[model samples]
Target: MIDRRRVLKALSKYPVYSPPFHNSEAVLSRSEIAANYNYFLEQKARRLEFLASYLRHFFVELSLSPEALPALDNWLLRYGGHLIPNGGEVLFAMNDYEPAWVGEYHGVNIIHDISIFAGDYIVMKNDKVRWSVNYGDGTKRDYEEIGFGQPCLVGLSHFAYTGNYSIFHGIYEFCYAGLRRLRNGGRGSKWERDIPGELVRRLNYLADPDPPPQIPVSQLTIDD
Candidate 1:
């Protein structure tokens, strides 16, 4: 369970800035902006640590391996195709692995932390766009949809047991909030609800137990 209080605290302190909302728009110096961006990233990194601790308890109870936790951390730091800065040294590569819109946009990058119920996977595309979801066969769904530059959070469940179950349950709530924020021109809309309900239904099928053997009705009639 994510600490509601902690998440609220982080959300309250999250930095705010106004920048032209286009990839080609010119802004301030890269050096100055980068400095502030690094500071913001540090705060996000700490918040991720908090989320990881919360997830650890769940993993232990389920007897699942915790190896995927580190990848989750890495995903957040580099999520949405932005690299973290440490004294001007790039900590990770944002090449084929980053979202497409990173270089296309000229402002502060957003961080989206995704936790799937099952499977261990990560993706990094250029800054233009990126998509990730669990398909229920140890394979993850990834793609770049049209209209990629918009700030959004998307979730998909092709298997009921995939991704964070709690998050899955709150999909509608998250989606409604995201849409509302987008309409109001909020800084960034939290995309918890962009997932399709149909997808969720299909995913439940993947998680279902094996079906029972079929019996011929004719055999029963003959016995009667």
Candidate 2:
């Protein structure tokens, strides 16, 4: 059986995260930022092996039998109950988006977004990468992240959007789990506290570890 509580406990230990400290002088210090980046790199070092193993095994299992893959209905029933409530409940929720392989970079996959926004590229070697060239949105500073946007907390130039679609897909799963936790037990009839809580939790970079509830929630209303 899945130990949800234990999973939450493990998730709580993610690195301390905050909004992009845009004005912080330390953002320019490659040395200081490098220090924090190294810390995050160390943490990633530990997870990389396990993730690689899991991905390798997943492909192996899928190759063994394509039928082993769960259908969309089963996927939703298993985890989509509360996360995707409305139009999101539909299959292929991201049908509006498209992924294109623009070219190869140093033998890595260079995926470009064509149909969506302006167009950005993700050049990933193997299963990981440290940076990319993001030309789609000028508002988001860090298209080239140091370590999955962990550096963004310090006012770094770019938020960390790493890997490829796989990593983005993984974030969706984590968000789903966060929504699951928000529900009182597994009964996610409707969103109450969990909606805002999940959003804030996602902002803080730790879905399991709760953030300090001191300011934002009190001032804003649904109408705002």
Candidate 3:
């Protein structure tokens, strides 16, 4: 029983996101960026908790009825202009060109590219995906394709068509693994680097619920 009305109403508020070409304003200084980055990192626990709860919500609430296929399509239509996190642009970068991580899945490098959108993961704020894991093969096959790219839409869309519960479960597991890794302080990626400064600023802007008329570095801080 997906709350169709509530979800649609929430989706209506977000304008289609358009990435800027280049920002000409003076970039945040290293200290300012570090403050924002620290703030973002401090929220990792909350982010993981929200992800876990949302996964449960998607699984338990995204329609398990006779007319599941139609129900899924109705929601997918509302998600128009939103790209799932896969090879698509997530947060500040498009990860299609390279594999961010490589990991053994049942003995081989079955898992290929993994992308994480470091945002609040709120639809009203236009958050798309928390993270996505792509398998080695360049083909779509339920969970093997893109790991919970759009959880309910992607996973349930396949389940509705095939009527296979295992496919849906696999996708859930893939997404949960990302949350587990994040809790352990790594992005489940090959690189153990900090997020880029440009992305840090963008995230600060998005997370600001009441942004002032003009943005300032101090406003981005979450002091002790």
Alpha-carbon local distance difference test for all models: 0.30, 0.28, 0.28
Measured with C-alpha atoms, the lDDT of residue 192 in candidate 2 is 35
Model 1 is weakest, by summed lDDT over 10 consecutive residues, at 89-98
Model 1, position 83: C-alpha lDDT score: 19
Q: Once model 3 is optimally superposed onto the true structure by TM-score, how far is the C-alpha of residue 109 displaced, in angstroms?
A: 29
Q: Give stretches of model 1 more than 4 Å off.
A: 1-27, 40-44, 53-224
User: In every candidate, how many clashes are there?
Assistant: 24, 3, 0
TM-score, candidate number 3: 0.24
In the order shown, the candidates' Cα RMSDs to the true structure are 15.8, 17.2, 20.9
Off by over 4 Å in 3: 1-24, 60-224
**Model 2: residue 147 alpha-carbon error in angstroms:** 9.6
Model 1 global lDDT (CA atoms, 0 to 1): 0.30
Candidate 2 has an lDDT of: 0.28
Model 2 lDDT per residue over 1-224, tens place? 14333322332332222222221222223344345445533543333333333223224121112232232223223333233322233112221111111111100110011100001011111122233211223335443332222322111212332222233333344335444654546555454323333322332232112224434554776437
What lDDT tens digits, residue by residue, belong to model 1 across residues 69-175? Answer: 34433222222122122122111111111222233221112222232222112112112212232112222222122112222213322333223233222222333
lDDT of 3 by residue, 24-62 (tens): 233333344344335434543444443333333334232
